[model samples]
Target: MNNNNRVFLVDDDTDFRESMQWLLTSAGYDVVSASSATEFMEIYQGEQGCLLLDVRMPGINGLALQQLLQEKNVQLPIILISGHGDIPMAVNAIKAGD
Candidate 1:
């Protein structure tokens, strides 16, 4: 893998976030995480990589953040993970070009 390989992980669940951090790090990808969409937006700098987002967060949620990123012209690939009831929202996000 390239040294620039990175994954931006945004989720409200601490356990899940940490777990994913470990997994991704073990897989040799540089991993960065934020506890919420707001936090992620605050720190993101349009770096080239993938975004791993949780669909059901407290403040902005994943889909809304995706839309915001689109508005800002971010073109990074996004992988949205949702719970059982949030599958539809995830699909909609994907359709919206997340």
Candidate 2:
């Protein structure tokens, strides 16, 4: 299958990741999920896609991952999701474009 337009999901919650995978799949998106940023990095091969990332995780949190991606010049678009995020976090995410 073509790699373009695939959706890369990175989150620590199994249930949330599965649910989002199901939802995105049901909507006809090609979905690839990983339990963490490290796992995602292992599987990703510079494919053209958008990322659905969790903001708070055990290691290499969303912001840190975003910075890492920036440093590597990865061009995939990222959407940061957080259930417990506050105003400051949201502001920071917006400013960081993640």
Candidate 3:
């Protein structure tokens, strides 16, 4: 793992997000988290890192967020996580080149 590696975690679950932040930090990764896509966009500035997104977030879902990032020419790698019923959506997002 790169020492300067960072992760942008976007999820609606506060507990999950906090837990992930702690786990990533303990693993030597710089982690930044947001409760919604809107919040993430407010803070993201084309930083060099990967995006860990929850597919079912409120106020702009993960796929939509990926599209917005693409529109803005932000090419960071994205990892989408979803519940069982949301797997199709996640697959579609990946198939769409997110």
Highest lDDT among the candidates is held by which one?
2
Q: TM-scores for all candidates?
A: 0.90, 0.93, 0.88
Write down the lDDT that model 2 would get.
Answer: 0.92
Runs off by more than 4 Å, candidate 2: 2-4
The per-residue C-alpha lDDT of model 1 at residue 71 equals: 90
lDDT of 1: 0.88
lDDT of 1 at 27: 90
Q: What Cα-based lDDT does every candidate model obtain?
A: 0.88, 0.92, 0.86
**Candidate 2 structure quality by residue, lDDT tens digits, 1-98:** 76765999999999989999999999989999999999999999999989999999999999899988988999989999999999998888888774
Model 1: per-residue lDDT, tens digit, 1-98?
Answer: 56368899999999989999999999989998999999998999878899999988999988899899899889979988877546566568769992
Instruction: Report the poorest 10 consecutive residues by lDDT, candidate 3.
Output: 82-91
Count clashing residue pairs per candidate: 0, 0, 0
Model 3, span 1-98: residue lDDT tens? 56258899999999989998999899988998999999999999878889999988788998899898889889888988876546567568878563
- lDDT preference between candidates 1 and 3, better one: 1
